[model samples]
Every structure is written in C-alpha cells, then in structure tokens.
Target: MRPRSVRARATLGATAVVATALGAASFALLGILDGNLVRGAQADAERQALATAATAAGGGLEPVLVPGRGIDFLQVVDARGRVLAATPNLSGSPALTPTRPGKPGTVRDTWKRGPVRGGQRHRVVQVTTVTGGGLVTVYAGTSLRQADTADETLKAVLAVVVPLLVLTVALVTWRVTGWALRPVEAIRAEVAEISERDLHRRVPVPRSQDEVARLAVTVNATLDRLEAAGIRQRRFIADASHELRSPITVLRTQLEVARAHPDPALWGELVSGALEDTVRLQDLASDLLLLARLDTSEPPPDTPVDLAGLLREEVRARRGGPVPVEPDLAGEATVRGSTLWLSRLVANLLDNAQRHAERRVVLSLRVDRGRGTAVVEVRDDGPGIPAADRERVFERFTRLDDARSRDEGGTGLGLAIARDIATRLGGTLDALDAPRGARLRATLPLAAD
Candidate 1:
C-alpha cells in the first residue's frame, strides 16, 4: 500500500485497538471495583449476622439491639420469619425480608428497602442457627451506598478519560505513522529488490536521526534475523526429510514386497510391520508438531501445580507392566506452569526412562524450599549414559542407538520436547551421574504460597 494508505490504516487500526482495549478495561474495572465493594459490605454484614445469631442461640440477644459497625440494622427472626428482636430504630417493625435462608449456612441478598437511604441498595445477610426456642435466623444488613458512589464516580471519570485517551492515541498514531512512512518509498524499492536469493540485502538507512533512520536500522536487523531464520529453516526441513525417509522407505518396501509376492501366509507379519512403521510415523509427526509449536508458540498462562501429585498420577498410569515404576514422592512441590505442559514433561521423562529401563523406573519428586526449586528425578537401571553424551541426548534426533530407537518407535524428540517444556516453564532438565544407571532430573521454580 502507498504511504498515505498505510498512514490512514495505521491510524485507524491503532485507534480502534486502543479504544476497544480501554473501553473493555474500563467496564471490567468498574465491574470489579463495584463487586469488590459490595462483597466487602456483604462480608461485614455476614459476620455481624453470625455474631448476632450466636447471641440469639444463647438466648442473650436484647429485644432492641445495637447495630454492629457498618451494619444498618439487625433482626433476629423465628422459624416463621417473624421478627422477634430488632435494632431500636426498627423496633415493632415486621420482618424486613419475608424470605429466610432455607439452609444452615449464610445466605446473602440485595434489598432496596429497610434503611436503603437516598435510593441506595442494601446487602442483607442471613445466618441460621438452632436455639433453645427452635431454629432462628439472624438478619444483618449494610448500605451499598459506597459501592454505588464508586461505580458512578468511575463511570464519570471513564466517560471523559476514555475518549480523550483514544483521541490522543489517534492523533499520536497519525503523526508517528506519517513520520515512519517518510522513507517507505526508498525502503519499498530496496526491499522489492531483496529476493530469496539475496536476503542479506538491507534497506538504506536515512542520514537523519529520525523515525526513518530507526526504521531503516530495524529493517536491517530484521533482514539479518530473516536471513538466519531462512538458513535454520532450510536445515530443519532437510533434517526432517531425511529422518522421515526411513519410515516411508520401510513402509513402502514392505508393501511392495507383499504386493509382488502375493503370499497369504505372510500377510499378518507384513500387516504388523506396516502398522508398526505407521505408528512410528505418527509419533514422529506428533513430535514434530510439538517441537514446532515449542519453537514458535508462547508459553501458556501459569497456574499453581503440585508436581508431586502430577508425578504420582503419571507413575500410577505407567505401572503394572513388565517395567514397574516406583515412586518416592515426598514433600510439597508446587510450581506455577501449564498443567498440560507439566504433565507432558513428566510423561516424556518417565517415558524415556521406561523405554530405557531393564526392570523398573524410579520417580522421585522433592521440594527444595531452601532453594525455592522443585526437583523431579527419574532414574532407570539401564545401560548408563556416558558422561560426554548427557547433554547430547537432549539435541533433536540425537539418538545414540538409532537402530534400537527406530525399532522401538522412538521419535528421538522426547527429551528435546521435555527440555523445551522445562525451559519454557522456567526450569531445567539435566542428566545426572548415577552409580549403576542413567538418572535424569528436572528442576523447576516452586510456586509461591
């Protein structure tokens, strides 16, 4: 698009984005603040209701009670919802709300009448308790005037601020876009000449220290990154093609031999072999998809996870096989991460260990509160890894025993995926030296209490 068109589009897009964001944020802020204020009022009223209900249960409540702090009024009602005792201001008045709590816990509601001054609403809380007389309900309430005032004030402020902020953003975006587009013609001409064959070519940097100059610098840096990314992408594609060829070749060769021979006796073995290769291909494809996502996707939102609990579930699921898994899950090891990613991480580690174990896999999860790290250790009694190849095994498709890995349907991306997940989760996976087996341990930052 031309500079004028780009300028217009940039201005409108930025303005729209900012305006929408601010509008939504304003509404959310208003709602959250209003709800919090009302909840605070309700909490205070509920506490007052509980205290008064206890008093009524003890038969110690005064007929004309004094309202608690922030409480507008208090009433002790019987099972029939008849007001037996009330605040002095509400003396001889009937029940404020005919509806009573049907259960044993605190129930809150909003009522506009009964001490709702100046068109304000009131938050009413009811606490039910068993007294000597029978089941009694204590009603307590507070005005929602503060919450209403806060909501109104926020609405007024946002009414003025949102438009002004949006207008400011529009004007600023218009000006900055024009400035950034000043050298777009030269950049366009230069970039148009930079084909895949000559990705190293960069746009001309303007002499002046302006947006165009900075734009030129950024464009040049971007070209550098693109050039590097292109090289890496080509290498990845080549390596992936080479790795994929083995299974395709095996599957194709098996099908061709069976088709040429036409042997009914060998049908089962041929089908089993094809199915095995097909499953390996599937595993490879899934691993590649995961690795690609790990390469480009952002880490998911974090939530507190109990790594010990997660490990326990994984261990339980992987047990009752030829290779039993023993778990020594001890202590609290809570960490913040996507549970899906964490589960995959544990699965990969355990899977790798289980694949390599001769008889059993030992899974250990411990909390290092002194260091604020959660350690998950998986050990297998297999032919131990050499000291020099510990880190090498984490590299993509870096199988030490390629023949064995291929036969066992290993994609060789398990450890790589685990390490990537651990890194994205702000953790580290390492192969540690063991006495008679291979031990791989992952350390993660513990979630805050």
Candidate 2:
C-alpha cells in the first residue's frame, strides 16, 4: 500500500468530521420541514371541505351540486341514507350514510369521479343537523405533486451543496494545518543550519506563550547542554594530554641522564625516580579511565547489601592506625549496588580520614529515622578542609596546598572517584564542617519493597 501524505490525511479527517455534522443537521431540518408541509396541506383540505358542507346545508342542492373551484366533490346525505345532492362525477355513487352525525368524521375513501386532475387519497368531513332526518358530507383533496416537487428540489440542492461544502472544508483544513506547522518548519530549517562549529547559534524563540513556544524552549535547552558537554570533553582531552606529557618527558630525561652517568648509584637513583613517576602516571591514567567509564556506563549492579556490615568490615580492615578508630553501626541497612564499587567508595573516605586525622577517627552507619535515608558518616580530629576548598576538593586532580609535596603520594582522584560512584548509586557524598575536624557523609536511598 502507498503511504498517505500527512497533509492529505489531516485534510481528509477534518473534512469528514465537518461533513458528517452538516449532513446530520440537514437531515433533521428536512424531516421537520416535510412534516410541517404535510400538516399544512391537510389543514387546507379540511378547511375547504368544511366550507363546502356549510354552504350546501344552508341552502338547497343546486349550490352544493355545482362543482366548486377547489373542492373535488361534495355529497349531502340525510339521516335515513338518501343523497340530497352531489357533483356530477360523484353522483352515480350510492347515497352516503351518516357514520357520524352532528359531528366531524374522516375517511380514506377514494374519489375517481371528481373534477380534480388526478385520483388521490382524501379526508372526508361530515356535518349533521339537529333534526334527525338529514345529514351533510363534503369532500376536498390535494394532489401529491406539490410535496413530490418539494422533495425533488431538496434532493437536487443537497446533491450540489454537500459536495461543495466538503471541498470548501477540505481546503480550509489544509490551509489551517499549514499555518499551524509553519513555525515548526522554520525551526527545523534553523536547526539544520546549526553544526558543531556554530553551537553559539540558536533558533529564534517565538513570542507566543503556547505549546510550540515551550517546545522551542526545550530544544534550545538541549542544545545548550550539548554545547556545554562538547566544551568539557575538549577541555578534558587537553588536560589529560598535558598531564601525560610531563611524566613522559621526565622519564625520557632521566633515562638519558642515566645513560650518560658513569656512577652506578647515581644511575640507580635516577632510575628509581623515573619508576616512581611512571607508577604515578599509571595511577593517574587508570583513575581517569575509571572516572570516564563511571560517567558513561549503565546503572550499577543492584544486589542486596548490608551497608552497616560493609562499613564495619572496612573499619576492622584498618584496625592498626595512628588515629584511634571507633565505629557505631546500627540497624539492618540493606541497599542495592555493586559491592566492588561501594567498597571502593567507602575505602576512599576512610583512607582520607586516616591520613588527615590528628588523634581519632569515628565512623558511623545507620538509617535516619525522620528522613528514612541511610546515612554513613566519617569524622576525624584532624585539621578539616576550609570552607573555600570543600567543593573544589571533589574535582579531579585537585589537591590541598598544604599537602602538595611528593611525599603525600596521593593521585588526588580519591574523592573524585568516590563522588562519581556515589552519584551512580543515586546517593550523595559531601563534606560537613565539624568542630574538631572534617566530617564526610554519604546518604543512599533506603531500599523499598
């Protein structure tokens, strides 16, 4: 089957609806007019019959016997069933009996012998006298031609008007659809003109506060996000390349220096320094790769996990430390997530706490009663992060100025990785200001049945 054009489909549907409504209205009007016309014709025939009966009853037979202009036939019968007078055409028939006297009666008797042009169905009216000896009847009729003619005329007009109406409606619908979609077409053309090279360009926003305007706003917002993501991707690539180049250059220079030096110990020391740089570079590259995968990968695996148990295990694993460790775990806090990733997320926070705490580190995991959220908090007595640098510390490769020396041996990606994993699990990781030292909290959604 051939596919139908959208414009044609829209126009056809609109036309069909309008035509159906018009057709129904016309049919109802025609029925009412037909009923009224038939009723009026019946009333006129009855009036003529009444007048004829009255005239004949008031005088002798001659006036009633004469053929009246519009009256088809007339007959006067006495109470004893004798015809007083009738028109020539109806004279041969037997004298009519008074079925009802002194009152009106109707019958569907035929009148072939009338002065009317054609035989037709008619209503008969009877008149009776107070004296029991006499009665009068009058007959009048109309040909069905007038009613037939009116019907034919209506049919002919409808034949012409209905098709014309359908055509006019189809045209109007087509024009209206085109007018409605004009803005959408313009938006499509403008969007086609925009490419990666011209992301600064935007589609024109329509002034009207309609659905089309809302659609345009949504499209513009999507475009803005794409542009921002593209810029971030370019920056990430440039930064990665710059970071990788430094260690590579240092390794190459160290190798060259060792090749030129004759002292074995000096050469060994240079080699060891190069090895350490190589290890650091490797760790940075691995962390970057992991961060990239986390951003782009699907949702984490959903498995039953006792979060309190996981925290206790992590705390026990780090039993020996410069700082005293205390853990407060309560409730059966079960969650759904990748165990490996969740362990890494928890481990990163604990390691950061251990490295910076002055004397004590406290870890706690429990479900918050009011909010119904699973909260895991790690606090320490060490110097806490300053308010100005708290947000910056979660970014990749960001380090505190006080801990920038090579001896720190941190890749500065620990908090970044932890935050990314937390986000993927539909949780939040944030630093909280504490009186003694820094406090970090990870809040996860409570598992719902």
Candidate 3:
C-alpha cells in the first residue's frame, strides 16, 4: 500500500476511531431498545392472558374462546398439562408454553415454537389461576416480528449517519490543519529563494507574533549580520590590494631603471632603496596576516603578565631610537592576557608615539588595585590629533598627515592592530585629549593573582 500524506492519515485514523466508537454505541443502544420492546411485548401478552382468564372465570371460559384482543396464542390447562380451553387459532393443540401452574397469581415468561403460526418466534406469558374446581394455567403469546423490524430500521439509520458524521469531521480537521500551516509554507518558499550572493534579502514576517513569525524575524536578523560581514570583507580586500600595489610598483620601477643603466655607482643606492621597500612590504603583509588570523582565532590563554615589566622592557629595547622616551612606572601592574599580544599592543602605541614625537615621548603604567584594572598611556610631544578624527584613528590604514607620513616608517595599520589585540585580551585602547600632543591609553582587566 502507498503511504498516506500527514493530513490524509490523520483524517483516516481519527475517523476510524470515531466510527468504531459510534458503531459500538449504536449497537449497544439498539440492543437496549430491542430488549425493552421485547419486555414490553411480554408484559402485553401477560396482561391479555390475565384478562382472558378473568373472563373465563367469571363467564365460564366460552366468551374468551371467541378470541380476545391481538394475543396470538391462548391456552387453559387444569393441573395435568391437558388443555381445558383454547383460542380458535390454536385448533385444539396442546399448551403453547412449558410453564406449569404454581401458587395463585404467579406469572412466568417462556418461549414457544408454534405449528399453526408458521413456526415463528413468540414471547409467551404463563399465568396461574385458582378457580372453584382446581388450579388452572393460562398461556398468552405474541410474535416478535414488529419489535425486530424496528431494531433493524434503527441499525440501518445508524450505519449511514455515523460514517457521514465521521467523514464531515475528518474534512473539517484537514482543512483547519492546512489553514494553520499556510504561513509556515510561505516562509519556507521565501527562504528557499534566498541565496548567499543576496544576503541583504530578508524573510517575510507575518503579522501575528507567533513562533513562525519569530522564526522569520530571527532569520532576517542573521541575514543582516551576514550582509554586514560581506561588506566589511569586500572593503578589506580592496584596501589590501591598493596598499600592496604601491610597493610592488616601486620594486618594478626600480628594477627596470637598474636594468637599463648598469652603473656600479647607482647600484648601491638602488639596492638600499629596494631593501627598505621590501622590509616595509614585509611588515605590512605581516600585520595584515595577523589581523586576518585574529578574525577566527580562539580566545588567548589567561596568563598573568606584568604590565610594568613589559613597558620597561619595551622602552629599554628602544633606547637607541632618535627621540627620548620618559618612563613613569608607578607599581607592579598585572593583567590577564597572552603575553605576546599584550606586548604587541604596547609596542604599537610606543612606535606610534615615537614616530610622531619631535623631542620626547612619555610612557606611563599604573595599577589601580581597587578598580582591578591596569592602565598604560603613551604621550607624544608631536602635533596632537584633532577631536573630530580621534575615533577614526584606530581604523585600518587610517593615517593623519603629520602622524603617518611615508618617510616616518609608519604603515598606518599599527594602531588598528593594537586596538584589535587589546579587545581580544578584554581591554580597550583609545586616544585621550593631550595639551601639546597625542595621548593613547590602554586599559586591561587585572589578573586574579
């Protein structure tokens, strides 16, 4: 057999259960009604027999012999199972029932098989009477044909009506289920039409604030996030390509010039210039690769790193730099983060400050034990960034004219990388207002120890 659809199967199963219940109930009701009718028929037969017996006793049995009412069988016997008087329809036959006479006014029910009445089933009532001579028995019976016919009619009607009712209910249930699922189907169709290339498209939310509507809203929100990520990815690619092209173009031009003129005197300067460009390109590519890795990298391990020690080391390492760096270390500042990333963050700030400073750069580290934070600030005596461009300074490849000149050995990605690394370590980096220069501050969560 072919498998049925959900609606069809549900309808069929429900209808079958209802039909079975109704069928059983119908049968029980018919049986009860038929039993009551049979009992009523027996009672009527007994009543007729009693009336006939009373007439025979009062008027000597001859008037009842002429046939009274519609009782089908009647017999009078006197103690020996011998018939004393009978209706004309009996034709001098024996007693119709096997019930014997007992105490006066006692009645009993019995079944009789008749010869003259075509052997049909009859419900017979036997009544005992005490007369002037001896105790006599009176039998009365009626055919069960009429009650049987009524029961048969009831069965036929129930058989037709129950199935009709079940079918009607099944149809109504199917239609209601379909109507409720209509919105879900619409959402499925709309979602099917969406593709990755058009993540800007959104699923339609129904007016009702039910589960299906909430699902559509959540799907649309996810699509919005994907669209934003796609835009950022495209912009990153374009910017990277533009930045990479500059060095490659310079390399190609310098190689072409060196190839045309093979003068030994120009070769030294050309090689030095090429080496510098190559180093700059390498540093830029490394920074870009680190940023890409950070996009998918797991959270850094939580290891206690002393911020004061790291700052001191960074300043000592840059001792040979052209600008003077003033260190203001207050206490043993500790934070929770990867030592490498935290060090890189500090180095980026120091490098930016060193590059922009004309005479001096200030490096400060302070531990706020009560606040549970480690704060690091690098201040430069260079022309400070404007208030309007403060937030934009941390964006990738964003460069102010005085801060990120080509001759200053700055790739314009240092601050961006530093901010990203700081965020990953549960810290924040921002530029603060300075009187004569730029002040960059980084705040990191303190280590438990």
Q: lDDT of all predictions, in order shown?
A: 0.87, 0.74, 0.81
Candidate 2 lDDT for residue 36: 70
Mind giving the per-residue lDDT tens digits that candidate 3 earns over 337-427? Answer: 7778888898899888888899999999888888888889999999988999998999877889734466777777899999998888888
lDDT of 1 by residue, 1-449 (tens): 53348888899889899999998999899989989999999998998999998888888978888988899888888878778899887788888767766666778899876554656788999888988878888889899989988999999999999999999999999898777777887898999899988997889898888877888899999999999988867876777898899889999999999999899999899999999888888888988998898888675558998778888888778768778899998886789997888998888888888788898889998888899999989999999789999999998787888888776767778998999999988889999999977999999999888
lDDT of 2: 0.74
TM-score of each: 0.50, 0.76, 0.61
Two-way TM-score contest, 1 vs 2, winner: 2
In model 3, the Cα lDDT at residue 274 comes to 91
Stretches of candidate 1 above 4 Å error? Answer: 1-232
Q: Which stretches of candidate 2 lie over 4 Å from their true place?
A: 1-8, 43-140, 144-146, 149-165, 321-325, 355-357, 381-383, 386-389, 400-407
User: Could you report the Cα RMSD, in angstroms, for every candidate shown?
Assistant: 25.8, 5.5, 7.7
Q: How close to the true structure is residue 27 of candidate 1, measured as C-alpha lDDT? A: 86
Q: Summarize candidate 2's per-residue lDDT along 242-349 as a digit string, tens digits.
A: 768877888999988888886788977897989988997987788788888897967677887778888878888888866767998877687778678889898888
Candidate with maximal lDDT? 1
* TM-score between model 1 and native: 0.50
